[model samples]
Target: MASIKAQAHHQRVRIRGYDVDIRTYGAGARNVVLVHGIGASGRYFSRLVDLLAQTCTVHTLEMPGFGSAPKPSHSLDMAGFAAVNCDALRAAGIGPAQWVGHSMGCQVVTEMALLAPDLVTSVVLLSPTINRGERNAVLQGLRLAQDCLREPPAVNWMLLTDYLRAGPRWYLRTMPKMVRHRLEQRIGGVEVPVTLIRGGRDPIVPARWLQELAAARPGAVAVELPGQPHVCMFTEPARTAALLREAASGQ
Candidate 1:
């Protein structure tokens, strides 16, 4: 949870046209949007927004089926998520802004860049998951399914209380769609400047994938946090904010 001071400085905006719930902070000319990963919400970027607000106007978006927004009625996939984000950005009057996404948010950012390249100035991907490969990808999906099945309802309650708040059935039904999403092709099509941040200790996404993405992009840089994990954005908001500032400034 973010401090009271941080939340006080941020403004909540509802964009009905896009069906988005957005948090806006600071008054800087440079605008930046933060997108959280699966089973998370805009609240995850509270600290990062606090840090970046000094030099950038930060916007954090809660997807249709997450955070305070209503659960999506239609079948939701990466593309659907991207479209909603795009509509939200437009409704919020954000144009050609720097986009920062973490984990599953990275995938959404990729899809947005592909879907509306002209609207994106640059992208910062945190712990992006790409190229799952044939064998390992299937195994990972199966493992996630098994874990979902084997874990006690209490464990699920403890870990995903926020998600449950959005809607248990919605979360359960959307879980499989997220696991099956593949963004390799869309990621390869990105032409804007990209900076990838990876937690060295993150087990979910390997360093090899980060390296590959960096190699593929025309102007992509990958940075690995020395002793961080999947939640590095929350665990290391200051460091992540610095990287985001650098990328936003075109450094």
Candidate 2:
């Protein structure tokens, strides 16, 4: 992938009564949408965006209640979150493209694909969350802490600061929907191709969970990058970008 030479286009558009910030990178024919997790902003995909911009137009969506976006009047469930993103993309004059998401963002994209299949060409989920076997928030938090030990300081710092930026009120209010979302069941509804990528050492999404996720769809493919933790997109951008490229290429 070529280094990102083009400047990104940053703008805020209204979506469901809230101003949603979205960044567009490159002017390539193919469209690639990047969705951050619950606590993270679209900025988390800076490196991956640079890589994907080489051959695809990358769109980073900063969901309402996260990043610099203002919180909504009330918490939105998974479907509501997807609807907001879909509406934002449409309002921005962007059409269907490859969808890439990290952690809770995976749930969001999966929901989007289900809600607007015509708007999603494919999907790539990184470190997807709320493993069916371990859906409780407390246990997942403990597992995330354990996984953090293996992550680099910069990765943990980014995660911590992003979580702080999101604030407890919003995170706590929105987390239940993420945990309760039937992502495993919902994945089956996505007719477009799906690719599931997990850090080999990611505690939040284990091997069995990845397998089950892949098994949910007849054409889904699961990839594991050993020794990488939950935020591999930050710590291992090259590998993550390469996998994303392959997924976007439909390889």
Candidate 3:
């Protein structure tokens, strides 16, 4: 997820006693749902939403304990996160949508399809986190630090603000859950269409892992945004939205 200022309709939806904040944009025929990664709120996706809102009704969610949503009594693992999100969307009368996620959000959407298959028409994973080769926390942290050097100052600042909101405690409690989830193994089994996108300069989601994820599904599409960093959706909104729009069209 990345940040930019834009106007959107905000609504609050509660599921399992958790109040989730959702931002809706556009009035197009197709619906797209954007999910943010660990320690990120929907705000990081503001820029991309502006581009996507042009041709698709886009919804951005702030899951409990992350983003603007209040912290839960306990940190939720990937499955719990998916369950709440799935029910929230269904409650909002949004379903069978193009579910797109970035980083850990990708794992959440994968679990979403598994938990509520009918709710997701397709999945687009952008810069998916916890690459198989760098599952350890230290390695992941090092990679993130390395990736930060590639990101512009603005993008890094936005990510820092979001991370601060999440706080160290909740983030640490949730980190293992993200590292442990077998997204690479689980995504291949999803019944719906799957697409994988990564920045050519992304250290988190390696080129080899992207290829492996693509190979998992017979018709899966793997795309690389050359010269883009991990948070390309923010800096390269138009191009990112184009790929997302294509996926939403069932292409």
Winning model by lDDT: 3
TM-score of each: 0.82, 0.95, 0.95
- C-alpha RMSD of each candidate structure in angstroms: 4.5, 2.0, 2.1
Question: Residue 52 in model 2: shift from native, Å?
Answer: 1.2
lDDT of 1: 0.73
| Model 1 stretches astray by more than 4 angstroms | 1-18, 130-159
Per-residue lDDT over 156-186 for candidate 1, one digit per residue giving the tens place of the 0 to 100 score: 4533666666676766666666667775556
Clashes of each: 0, 0, 1
Better of 2 and 3 by lDDT: 3
lDDT of each: 0.73, 0.86, 0.87
lDDT of 2 by residue, 1-251 (tens): 22452477788989659777888889889998989998888766877877777778888988998988888888888888899999999889887888888999999999998888888888999999889999998998899889889988877787799889889999999989899998889899888889999888898899999999999887998999988888878778888888877787783
Q: 187-213, model 3: which lDDT tens digit per residue?
A: 878888888999999988899999988
